[model samples]
Target chain A: MSASVALSVEGLAFSYGGKKALDDVNFKIRSGECTLLLGPNGAGKSTLFSLITRLYDTRDGRIELCGFDVKQQTRKALANLGIVFQQTTLDMDLTVLQNLRYHAALHGMGGKFANQRIQEELERLRLYERRNEKVRQLNGGHKRRVEIARALLHKPSLLLLDEPTVGLDMPSRQAIVEYVHQLASSKQLAVLWASHLIDEVYPDDHVIVLHKGQVKANGTVDEVLKATHTGQIKDAFYSLTQGEHA
Target chain B: MNIIHFWRALWGIVGRELWRFVTQRERFISALVRPLVWLFVFAAGFRAALGLAIMPPYETYILYEVYITPGLCGMIQLFNGMQSSLSMVYDREMGSMRILLVCPLPRWFLLLSKLLAGTGVSVLQVYVFLGIAWFYDIQAPWQGYLWLLPALVLSGLMLGALGLLLSSFIKQLENFAGVMNFVIFPMFFMSTALYPLWKLKESSALLHNLAQYNPFSQAVELLRFALYAQFNQSAFIYVFVAFIAFMAVAVIGYNPSKGMMIKKAGV
Candidate 1:
């Protein structure tokens, strides 16, 4: 419950029918930091994202974004939260400007202020040149940039991306990862970057390793490596998720 | 939420609906074409076989095309309602709906705004069909056009609510065609859209009773009466009540706790 914590979850639990999807999980992402939620496929990453975004109600635990409880203060909490879902959400037929404007409108930004912010964010993403182009015409990297730009239009304090780089080529993937890291540092925005790829993690970055609906490990990369008795994160991740053979 | 924000969100959703409607030319042509065919082709064929009686709103006999124009208007609204819901299903599966539901507004506000937007589009389609019918020499009183406004709005809201309710239950887009065959076809066929209630009674007592109870029939009746600058109190009551009931269930269907938003967590 520290003031610096931008996103907080305590004892969150979820299930579908007889199967448990998330179990008593707790974690926090502080302002001005990027936390890598690394887990393999089918490891409950998407489910956690769904709950955090309030797309699915939190059945058993509390989730607070910027100190506002998600369920109790849904409006305030969601206003402070921005998300880039794994799937491409841009209207394929709408121009980049139209897509961003629609998103801005959804967040209650309009008129001169919305236009100014749209220009600034698109410029920041180096996507201003293609502002009038339809989203489908943009390359994968540019489309991802547009999504990032749209996510930042309202200036949310916390940003969530669920496997954002899933289908991108290596260059686009690396660029997006780097851009998000820079976004966190420059804007003091807290970020939760979920992915199954180990290479996306850095030694100094915070990491939360989830597997089998449980948070197997959560700390700095070095700490997780130390806890799992491994020399590198790749080894630590495999050992923690697949059992200890290292 | 601030009042300005609420208005902005509503405008945004409605604008998006308009944008999509304009971009999909095929949808526009088809929406108009379906009812136009019923008015010109089907009514022409049935005009010989059916005889008109002195109904309450009409003192003299009317052509079959003239009689069914209002009903055809109702059909356009009904189809537009279902088409909007179809897009909603596509949005949900494609992840854009997730973006929409995450807005800071109340869920009911968001849903109601969406329904209103769809209703607005459907209303526009109804007017277009009426204009086309006017060109074909089937006309109502000019004042009836004004009276028809509220009737069209009410019918659109009622049918859109039905579509919203169906969208909540339809999990996948592939199953939507089945919903059309089951819900749309039955509702359209079983109603008095094709024939008067008296005519239906002559055909089958059960059909007369069923048509009397059908909400779609009531909506068409309301529209038919309003086209002559008159009102059917019973039809109005029936449509109002059905609108309330369908809307309540549709709102509940979009509730995050009960709606399609929730997915079974990956085991």
Candidate 2:
């Protein structure tokens, strides 16, 4: 399949008071592809998310989103990306629909068009009925779904999520994963889903295993598991990244 | 490209905050209580103890209660500054900061919107204080109402920007307590709020000079003049400089890449 890269990074590095958070990290997500960036805690996964989202700046490297430099064309680069951070951003006092409207306005979408898009997005997230409910009244799963809905309102080409399901019940987690895969397939949205869980990365999905801020494995699940010579993907991950703990 | 989103997001955040402010009736009322305590209790107590000769904004012998209204408004902005920053710390720990930081617009604007919203809340509180001041027979020139609006806005911006700047530096909430003791209170009392500069000069020329130089003192003086339906070009310039300096620092503090968010130590 002929495809263009939706996200591209080269020689990215960041530090804080001389502590390395991300080091020489590099990767790319092709258009319409759902790629999982798997890493353990402190493996620089969040840091990479920060840099790609322009939360961090680095003169040592470059990041281009849909062929635009993140540092230079910040607003333009951000317009092409939709991000659902692990931390919930929804205003608890606001109705679900108001949250979407605010985001639409933030993206300069207003009036009739913004209202139409808001309805369309809420329905897509299966949140049409709960549009008027304050977010504090929603369940954890529903809140997460609302965030996913908010992320989609602008129809961003590149969707990024950083450990979005860290603390949730099995049902909620499973539902999120199910919805995400469904959305990716239906919308052909290029996704860079970062997580530590191996099961989240499917057999066919492109997987990049990051260890200590560097790529230890990249390819399909079968390839990463085969490289570590482990039957279970979890065991393969631990074997490749966890030295003495193994 | 779309200010609608930016303004809408700002409205959403401000609306949420405003609702929070109103819902917590005790908090909303309490915000007024601290400044009023100083106005009625402290100012009344000191009325007989201290006497003002005359001041620029004051045409004749003025009551101490009237003299302190602008200072009280300044105090409201100052206290609200810390409150806003403290809320930012709480939001950061609560994970809500992430939601705001990821907004499509520039991070600086997002934080500015937040600051402006906070200033709105602060100004609302100041008006309430002014209402109470009116009941106590303390009032500004009736026409002064028009000029006071921009003065409030400029001072509010300076204080809001100061709050955002502080929010960007402090890593923890507990650390802010020390700031109140050393920075906030001193910044309040050391200014020409409670007393005139000439009065301070009679006591000590150095302290008077320092009080005159305090950016906050300039803000209060500008308000004093505006409330008298007059202008203070030098004082306006001084407040303008402080506002710009504070805003520049705030913009840098919230630069996203090199800001207080990255310095976060887990919590």
Candidate 3:
């Protein structure tokens, strides 16, 4: 594996009893790039994320992070990964700083260094002023920002976001999209963002169209558009999945 | 993982639990109130009804409240264990558990840390209950208080592990009430918590045998002896072994490959 390749999955497959959730799925995400994993509901998006995070063990295939095998060397592999789950995972009663500190401690970060990193991430997200406030006091968008800050505190090479903006307002969604895109380019962080919203895809972003537990298309935005014989991502996505859902 | 990482993760889990416990005043109050009510009202009402013989731990005849103190301590731990597991189920459903599971540590260690954290919380609750019991003039020997610490830790861990094991089986918040009705009540009532083994034997041989084998009985017996600065080897061994067995299965239940996560993944 190349040093820049932060995440690699090959021949990944998972099943719940007799029903297959992810079927021989394969993908790689490199640092300094954002990969949009576009799929509708029940398209195995969550299954793939579960596999990557080792929430469910991978049996049929292999997943590696930063050159470490996820199954064999799970500790090292996961050390290079930061994740913002689909649901808001913050402790609502705890202050924003306490929540981030808890996360940092979980990753083996502590003392002065952990506090410094926390300050930097919160400042970068423009949430430094609200650090003392309880997460329950923050709005939805601000909570998401705190989660993002917490995810980055450990400075993982790869970041996975599972439909993070599903319930946010338009402005909040746009802000997160812009922030993540900028973060990926500036920090050389590899990001695999799962979303069904076609409008969230940028022209420069790499796109992977997953449908029915299979990757229908994987390429640049322009490449997918050209390959599907469409002008817009909406058309490309519809053509790729045969208009299953937007 | 290195020892420092393991230690930090454990601290984080325990610290978060303590922070939550401090913030939820109602949780702490309710945890105390249940045992306190039993100590204050039930024990008082039953004091006249139930006459006591000289139990092994007690050199002289004891009041009903004094007899049930250790049992009530076990009750505090029992309820705290279930309460912690209830939070685990809620965390799993609310998605916060995912954050903890995804940490760069062994799943067993993470679960163990969680068990330890719950044990810590329950121990705190037990002490507070003991303190209040002291105010009610049900004081143990001064050194017995010291001995009770390790006893409480062991009992807390065993009961918390049982709760952790139960949490893995519980899929939704809705199923928790069923557990309270089924597991908690039966374990508390059938054991030596409220009555002695001889009393249970007089009532029914079946209940006597059940209470004899009940791990909660062993826990309470262990605490009962420790409260007098005495040690019951059998109860100690029983609780220790129970802790190990429950912890092993609880770890297995949380295993993603071989356990409940498989069924949960489908959800």
True contacts kept of each: 0.77, 0.47, 0.85
> Between prediction 2 and prediction 3, which has the larger TM-score?
3
Candidate 3 chain A: worst 10 consecutive residues by lDDT? A13-22
Could you give candidate 2's per-residue lDDT for residues A12-73 as a string of tens digits? Answer: 88776677777787778886678888877778887788778776675568998888888888
Q: Summarize candidate 1's per-residue lDDT along B144-249 as a digit string, tens digits.
A: 9999999999989999889988888788999999988998888988898888888888889998898889999999999999999999999999999999999888
Worst 10 residues of 1 chain B by lDDT: B258-267
Q: In model 3, what is the error at residue B108, expressed in angstroms?
A: 1.3
Enumerate residue pairs that collide in model 3: none
Order of quality (lDDT):
3, 1, 2
- List model 3 lDDT by residue over A27-123, tens digit each: 8889999999998788899889988888888899999999999989988999998999989999999999999999988999977899999999999
RMSD to true structure for each model, in Å: 1.8, 2.6, 1.0
**Using Cα atoms with residue i matched to residue i, what is each candidate's TM-score against the true structure?**
0.97, 0.93, 0.99
Residue range B1-267, candidate 2, lDDT tens digits: 655566677776777677677777888898999989998899999999988877687889988888888898898988888899888977876767766766667776887778888888888888888888888888777888778888888888887788788887888888889879977888898898899888888889889888989888998888889888998999889888887888787777767565555556331
Candidate 1 B-chain TM-score: 0.96
Estimate, for each residue in B68-164, the C-alpha lDDT of model 3 and write its tens digit: 9999999999998998899999999999999999999998898889988988888888889999889999999999999999999999999999999
The CAPRI class of candidate 2 is acceptable
Query: In candidate 3, which residue ranges exceed 4 Å CA deviation?
Result: none
Best by TM-score: 3
- Please give the ranking of all candidate structures by TM-score, highest first, separated by commas: 3, 1, 2
